[model samples]
Target: MTVEVGSPAPDFTLKNQDGQEISLGDFKGQKAVLLVFYPFAFSGICTGELCSVRDDLSSFQNDDVQVLAISCDPVESIRAWARQEGYEFPLLSDFWPHGAVGESYGVFSSDLGFSFRGTFLIDKDGIVQFLERNGPGDARDQQGWRDALQDLAA
Candidate 1:
């Protein structure tokens, strides 16, 4: 099921690097959510993209918005990666079900055993306001995310 703009986002609870259970509905009525799905942890492209977000965290994560990065890697791997990279935001592990959340968002590659790069911005009301999908090895331009957040604010 491909999640589309203006539709309700699929809700799921996953464990972050710190072993915290975070649910999509947790941000409802408080903050918009930016769900970032990536293939693996500690990879070069994924590191570059996520480090960009980490560097400009205030833009993606503030009172109005929360950024959640998800991957199929095990919790221990993500925990180590987050610590190694000094990532302040949550790095969620979608490992137990092995990409269930990614599959729900239509970004999981079953044959590849991982998720492609996918981004979804869901509003406080649980509606998806923006969506973008990129295949493996394709890097996403975060400017589009900032632009969408600007529109969401306006």
Candidate 2:
């Protein structure tokens, strides 16, 4: 039940690793958002995918876009993970409502008590421009995201 393309991106206010509140709607009319929903903070596949985003952050954070990674991990764990990985992007904590944000996006798994690997590229207008979800233990290729961003610019 991942949110479909052309749908309005849901709005949410969640604490980042730094305990700062961030909302999706804050970016509207400013920058497109890359909302990444992952199961955990320090897991293997999750780390790899986010690191790739970290490695190419400029491409994602120029005048038009920004990346925000969300997970069910507590803010403390997220803080440690972000500090360890040198991730400058916001790593939001969905632990208060226990994955409610991911659930709304159709990525949370009640059975597993976590979220699948779901990525949504939302445009400045709050419309979902691209969407992809992978089951547990699966990896994601980030090029598709870049291609979609290119299309958005075109």
User: How close is every model to the real structure, measured as TM-score?
Assistant: 0.99, 0.96
Model 1 residue 147 CA deviation (Å) reads 0.1
In model 1, the worst 10-residue window by lDDT is 1-10
* Candidate 1 per-residue C-alpha lDDT over 1-154 given as tens digits, one digit per residue, 9 for 90 to 100: 6799999999999999999999999999999999999999999999999999999999899999999999999999999999999999999999979999999999998999999999999999999999999998999999999999999999
Q: What do the candidate models score in CA lDDT, each in turn?
A: 0.96, 0.91
Q: Candidate 2 — what's its lDDT?
A: 0.91
The most accurate candidate by TM-score is 1
Pull out the clashing pairs in model 2: none
Per-residue lDDT of 30-50 in model 2, one digit per residue for the tens? 999989898898899899988
Count of steric clashes across candidates, in order: 0, 0
RMSD of each: 0.6, 1.1
The number of residue pairs in model 2 that clash at the backbone is 0
